[model samples]
Target: MSKKRNLRPEEIAMLQANACMADNWSSVFVPENFDIKYVSHTRFSGEVTLGAFNKEFILPGGLKKHAGLRHVTLHNCRLGDNCLIENVQNYIANYDIGENCIIQHVNVILVDGVSSFGNGTLVSVLNETGGREVPIYDWLPAPLAYVITLYRHRPQLISRISKLIESYSKEISSSRGSIGNNSRITNTGTIRNVRIGSYATIENCTRLENGSVNSREEEPVYVGDSVIAQDFILSAGVILSDAAKIVRCFVGQACHITHNFSAHDSLLFSNCAFENGEACAIFAGPFTVSMHKSSLLIAGMYSFLNAGSGSNQSNHMYKLGPIHQGIVERGSKTTSDSYILWPARVGAFSLVMGRHYHHCDTSDMPFSYLIEKDDETYLVPGVNLRSVGTIRDAQKWPKRDKRKAGLQLDPINYNLLSPYTISKMRKAVEVLKNLQALVGETSEIYYYQNTRIKGSSLRNGLALYGKAINKFLGNSLIKRLEGTAFSSIEEIWAQLQPTESRGKGEWIDLSGMIAPQEVIENLLRSIEAGEITSLEEISAIILDIQKHYYEMEWTWAYDMIESVYGVNLQTITAKELIALTEIWKESVVSLDELLYADAKKEFSLTSKIGFGVDGSATEKMKDFEGVRGDFENNPFVLAVKDHIVKKEALGNELIERLKVIL
Candidate 1:
């Protein structure tokens, strides 16, 4: 909207002739060249500004509509250039609409009194009864929300951050709402105090009140038919369609909540999809998807999670008043009809099958499974390490991300084998070894935190953990040492030296980002000490950390190199390096072999049972091959086989380079 001049006497008579009524005709101002012919049956009151109507909009299917104001009532509104505002059933009041907007057939759209436009809305995530209330703002990122919701021990830190958000909300609070350029609001019911952004598409929505559709030209937000969102911050590229209702939530970039999905007091981050399900007080991190109507995700914190049909949790207990919460760590999956009593913690990339009455905590274990047998939970630790599904998930996450580059709010690190998970694996190995030592290594009934583990499973868990550690450390080592000539052991040691000192401690996953715990703590301390002032500063720091991930990752990996392999870095020899490389190659090959076998099982005869439903066994085999492809030629299978070969060749090349020192 720009400066406007009052209408001339002839123009006023023209408007009067066109049946346009104004409470104060002197208060109505229009831009130069704003034709009176384009304004008809429009009622204006109290300082309304109207732009020139010189453009025509060619809608989808070639339906053309000239930019004009018809049958619309504007109260203290500023209409931008070339906007087509018609058929406002009630009115559009106290708003500054931007250029090229379309407001058609909408009911009441007004900013009543003071409003923050969904900023400072408290989302009681991971607990319905309001213990962890995350204040959502327009720029709320995943890592910041993670700390605010989970780090309750630091009350002062939370208070400082909360105050920052409150100050920000107050700063941006206004008596008038905004509709950015090229935004479209059509066939809507009511839009009260909602801040719509550039290129936003809001059509046939029942209601959108006190929310911020933070859309942009790069990727627009879409609100479809029968959708209702209140006190929410829907980020760029978000889609709320098909009766999707979100209350007091902050939906991050590229999230899709459609098909009658209901979410309340939840924070759904980037790339999350919720269709036909219900989310209550959950901190749904990046890639958390629940597509079944029967699925109820409540009082839980999850990342990279896939909740199966009828998969649910019990947050209420007879003793406590729905106070319990759970965490299904990143990359975890729940089977259909699975149930977990609250206060359980599933490990990263683990699978949960069947109901478990006993609460289990497997945070120290990264890739495992919890299965029920005879009403008791049986733990298969580190089994997902060799799972074909796990590998495919790790491969597909980066590809599945649909958020455009400019609108990426979540600082996502798609590494399944980061220092965060490897550190958990290290602790798991210690816990497993401690259990084995206490219960005799041959014992069948090994108990760990409300679950039973068999001896064979225990042994396999240790071996798998060891292999994964080797693979991660070797990967880090290669990444650090590659493409550089090492003339001596000193040179190799120099290359392996940590560049940054901050990554030498335990690493934690902040919903999507994996960074050193001390680094995050230092950031919190800065907030607590009032060193860090704004939310933008916090987001910038977190994104910078995400960019420098591999640099910091190598620092963490370097610290573990000596302790895990029992090698002295100061006096390291070429032969020892060669040995380490050989061990890495073996681990890599063995893991690939396990993956190969796991993929082969999917192409087995039993897996082909229903492939050729009306044909013989031979036809079944042929049809299975046709549909699922032969195992050796399948994409994942080929990748696995190629991974083994590439790793082996790289290790051999490194060993050959080391042999030159002999």
Candidate 2:
């Protein structure tokens, strides 16, 4: 923004000789030391201000292009210093191009009237008919969106939030667009009413209108060849390339949508990957991934989900139009070709295989398997508790987090065992025992929630749920006093008390955040009462929930253990603690052994059939070993064995320490 002056008579003569034409010479302004040698064959109309163009840009192979305007038309625009603009088919209008930017061979870039760059756009997520529309803004996080989209019972809260977002959108609305500094746009197509962020790359895009690429210096947004996005807000570190197209979507930080994937009316959060698939009216939470071309995610709410190839769902089974929506809890997976009719609920960490049409609800049965047996939906509860795949997924999510830079919008909880899942496990135990009691224990099959359970499956479920409960409670107890030194049994009893006021009553998973329901309700009440006004306050509270997860977890576990086993934390004896620790140690070792057996299945003879390629059995085994490694030395197997020893030692050490103070 240096001091601008009218073009001198000598500069006007030089520009006329160089084939540059301006409707009114007085309307064109430049800096005191603006160079005129680089302005040629360019048409300027309306008010135009030019900056110094003294630098040359070096291309990939060292070809240099001097910074200047050539073969282009500009209207009512302000050009920054050292910007090279060339080969624009249509005129650039109502824009402020930043310094050190290169715009080449673009079809057009303009702003038509006042634009908000896609903010305050309502995306019909979860239900396309408009009952569950979420107003998308630049700062919309998953927790806030989860509340706004799903908490429609409170109309005032929704209306207030919608108004807040509309106000924000109007605050940023402008009649002109801007390209941030150090950005590169080459071989692109139409870009209208889009605000590009710093260091963003837009190359070979077909059409991008009414969007905001909220890129940053550390995490730049990238839109590559053949991409077309409209009415979208792309957070930082997003990679949308390879002909992918999205409309009416709010893509969160570090998400990847590539390989011709198409998404419409969806809200996708961080670290999610939608490749070669299609999504419609879905609320995809953190790490919800679908990597196959045949996968279609429609009218469902998913978090930490992995949809296998050919996985799909039916939303319009009723006479009414597609009004039914389903909720797949966190950490669930669908096997290949698996399908579920809408209005169903899949439990957290559950696995769904085959097709289900009974509209089963397994929200009270976490870590189970839902399979169609003889075309009847069969539920095997607590089976995924022993799955190595489940453990690996939980371990890999934190490591695979791509939001290494930028403001993380989603606060993800990566724990495999938490109060959220454990409460469901406790309820599952009751549901299984009640089923056994109601329908005699020897029955071949039992029914609950429109799904059948085998007699043996129910028995095994009770045992597994009991063991899992013991393990979780004991783990919480040990964690609360892991490094603290206790002098007497009285001190141990005092330490068992909850330090936080939250975590009592119900616990829930708000997309990726695991928090006590009481606290969440309080937050909503605050919103209802106008105590919480701004989006920043909500975000700050959301972060505080994650920041103090362990403290809140202990409070829930303390009450749950008392309710399950009648072990009162107030007057619990050392002997009772020793017994509980023994039970926990056994459960931990038993589950690890099951995992070890499951890992052995991967290296069995049947698994080696295709490895040798026309060879003997010995060769087949050797080939399998060479490629997949020996089972005994496998990383997961070794880890499981190590886990057994470590749990045993921890239990023994705690017992001995308790004995010292007995």
Candidate 3:
């Protein structure tokens, strides 16, 4: 859309004197405001547009490279205002380099044909053989990826969804790549068929081909030294550095892949980090961290997971290819040298510390420890309920979110005691009781699932489960009726009734999203019917579920309340409510006291041995105090102690308020 103008004959002659050549001189179009002082040694052809180049740029070490082209060839390209293109070993073809961009020392930057810039690229995730491929896009969230990749049982729904993504990819396909305003690409190897966003810094990258760096002025993208990525969509604020190699991966916002880590066919969502490790065909949800060089995560689904050194899982036996997959639920950790055979599910917040070949199913026993002794797997159920590390992990995850993207791709639930894990604990309690009842009480050991449980461990597990259940139910009741005035028994009962009935079924963790099964069914119905079109709308639905988790959780927990207490909640009296509240207070305080004692072990005398190097014993004590602070003054330890006092006050206050009606 331009008013036609003829170039002055003298000006055209001056341009030819500046070593500027073109295959067809009439095809080159320059704007009316363009100043050609810096146009030197440039060749243009095939409907090109040149912008005003009137600025001097100071390069590295204060060497000035003025705004123009030098020893570069452009074909079917648009050069915007104040851009400096120099030292291109090969030509940049079919591109629109934006204003104020500096493209130097690049081998080639071009687009061969119509491309979607990695959107809707079939990333063969979770299975290396291509049966399960997720169509990756710029707005692909983890929950949607989980449904698309894992919900293969409903083939029609997946097909319908895949067709939608394919249509979107076709709609966005283009033949030219773009470099946005104020971007910098220096000392890079090769960039092909990629869309670099504004203010992005691409330096020393070996190769970045067929990707979309969704960068912006607010949060730019950084592709650092020797990074090679292909068929990827890197969201804003992500760091790809340290020779990390990736293929067919979706690196979500604020994710870090560094230290020569190699990933293929994986979906790494927001805030996931991979350092010196390897991941293949894995679905890594938010906060999935693997820092050890020896760890390998392949064909597994994980969230809030920490893989220890030499932690591994076998997805294939000798009989078949890598077809098997496992689920390590959220907030789970593996100790050093832990291994698990595939097709097993570990419950939430559980710790796996040893190798197991029996394929033990510990999904019913959460917050437990699975250990290996003499080639036998021992299940110490509910041990994590008393461990200080579990509580610390719950406290730390919320503080560690690093995503700066305006729209978060993962809706993370950081609750320590949700229906997802509490229901499992309730099942564990029943399982322990069943073992005790079926076998004689005098039995020294019992076998359940594939792991052995000693008598003492079973008893301790039952007790711990009871305490945890009481703690959770109490928390629900207190939160539901905290500020309400319960004048009589009927008022207290009315408060206990759920505000909504949507949560009265099984709960599930869809990658990072926690919601009821009915909601998931509704979402699938909508997707099948073409109601959910944009990926952002689907993400909105997931966030709505996460925000309403408590209301839905109450419905699920209420059904279990009647069975656990053996009382009808509708006719429960004020005295019963007060009693439940009292038991809750005791359970909460007891757990807090145990956590306080456990935290003291870290600051004991044994921990002081290495603190004071070349010092006396008294000096060692001082050194430990100075370095590690006093135990009572430690942040986590003090928080635990203060928690007991605060809960005691809250429980007594509630009891006092309820006693008046009783």
Candidate 4:
């Protein structure tokens, strides 16, 4: 607590000489060593508390100015030590400015009345017509928000979650806002009820109203030129700049929205980047990126997605308002000029190309391609299993994670071959085989779920799905038995038993989290029963599920192995295990070979056409190699070859060790 003392006669004379005036000098409190030398042309009204301003701030381009109040009007404001507030256009009212902050050339910053600072604001996400409104707070996790948006069948759960957030909002509601320490607000206009955090830089923002910029010393938030954000919560490590317009949104940690990107009623989770695009009522999960000017993502749910130029979606049909929504599962990509009508669901790791007006649901066919030709939707199932782009995307997401500080609220599982996708692949294998059996293998075109599958595509899909399934199961098996020693069949069976049975049936990718369906169901049940009451509790539960993912995945994989291979683990011998190892090796090598060939396509003669415009074929080859490097030495190609060698050696070693047990 700072003490209020009367200004000395000499100090009052100096302040008056400096053109500083106070409505009531007795009502203002200043430190004993406070100097009126640097403070001038300032008017103070109501209650004002001032701290010592002795430090000098160095500005850009080698200019320096001492920290003090100059040419500003303060109304019931408290200025901390070593802060500079100069050239306020309107006034700053009811703000507790922190130490070492610089508020210069601001139009008006005030808290007019009690404000929740964007908390408890209902953002109508997913479905734009209402009903899926999530009351966003600072700590809203993706999984919790996922439940709130999708689990509307459980009304009690929704009510409980809403009340929890609302209660938290009420607790933090205040009539006076605060600017944190080491923050800088320069050339900003009309910042109303915005609670900025420490080390934040708000520079040249057009308008920021009713939001919480949750910046911190470790990862400061940056709000730059021409940005307009309202009813939003910008999380730590977020950068909203370059005329970005955000409304009724929650921009999560490490998210960068720039280049005139517009987002409304959206929740963009950690590590997502939006540049020159527009998003409305979207639930963009971790690593969702859109970097094109013509991209419009609306009323959709996506995670680990990459939207190319002119990629858009239509949520409104003609009858109802913008009420429909779509879900593109994790690791999907929309090629240039791709569009999808609402109420569609794309499976994980799929590629969508061309416009599709039909609301096709390809949720069971993971790693496929949905193409449009002459107003017909063509589905090529499981071909993305061998796509170099899919492999590159999976390899890049972990390296591209930009959340360097703060607790990551969204639990992202960056596995390219998780049980979620493997389960879908298994279903796809069954679906394709069933389609062939029912429609006859001689049929040229087979129809399933509003999409046409060619006969060759069906056969190729079945083969690709088989290879991927074998790779995933073998990977899980090798990991499970990596260091275990089994001398007998009983020993092997004991080691192969699942650690838990809860992960046997189904799995789901809840935004970015990959978990067993049973576990999610259990958590939802707990929420419905009021066992989970707060946001923190729900987040803890979701993180716990993420923590034990591998163990639960083994549980799911063990059952899948037995079902797929027709093996009775209780009676299987070392010879069977060795055979499984051989199959695993073959699958691993085959997929690696496919990836290698795919990489080679990038270095082909056709790829060298534009490299050497005025040179011969030899010069074009040289130029292409100079830019893209040799195919054998490329990082991805080398990694693919290395993976093949390591997996073969591993499988051989495992087979030999199993033979010893026999």
Candidate with maximal TM-score: 1
lDDT by residue (391-434, candidate 1, tens digit) is 88888899989898764789998999999999999999999999
TM-score for each of the candidates: 0.99, 0.97, 0.95, 0.97
In order, candidate lDDTs are: 0.92, 0.91, 0.86, 0.91
As for TM-score, the candidate ahead, 2 or 3, is: 2
Model 4 scores a TM of 0.97
Answer with 3 or 4, whichever has the higher TM-score: 4
Off by over 4 Å in 1: 1-3
> Which ranges in model 3 have alpha carbons more than 4 Å from their true place?
1-8, 54-66, 486-495, 531-534, 567-569
What C-alpha lDDT, on a 0 to 100 scale, does residue 492 get in candidate 3?
Answer: 76
1-662, model 4: which lDDT tens digit per residue? 35556688788788889899989988778887778798898888899899888999999898999999899999999888999899999899999989999999999999989999999999999988898999999988888888899989889889988999999999999999999999999999999999999999999999999999999888899999999999999999999999999999999989999999999999999999999989999999999999999999999999999998999999888877899999999999999999999989999989999999899999999899999999989999999988999999888888988777448888989998988998888888889889989999999999988899999999999999999999999999888777765677788888888887678788888889999988999888887788877778888889889989988999888888899999987688898888888899999999989989988998887877798789987888888889999999999999998998999988887887788788
TM-score (C-alpha, index-matched) for candidate 1: 0.99
Full ranking by lDDT: 1, 2, 4, 3
Question: Per-residue lDDT tens digits of candidate 2, residues 1-662?
Answer: 78999999999999999999998989999999988999998899899999899899998799999999988899999988889999999989999988888999999999999999999899999888999899899988898899998999999988878877888899899998999888999999999999989889899999999999998778889999999999999999999999999999999989999999999999999999999999999999999999999999999999999999999998998679889999999999999999999989999999999999999999999999999977789999999988889999988999989886437889899988888888898889888888889999999999999999999998888888888888899898877656666788889988898999888988889899989999988888888888977877888899888889989999889988888779888999888888888888998899889889888888887888789898987888888889999999999999999999999999988888787777
For model 4, the superposed segments whose C-alpha errors exceed 4 Å read 1-6, 485-491
RMSD of 4: 1.5
Error of 3 at 453 (Å): 1.7
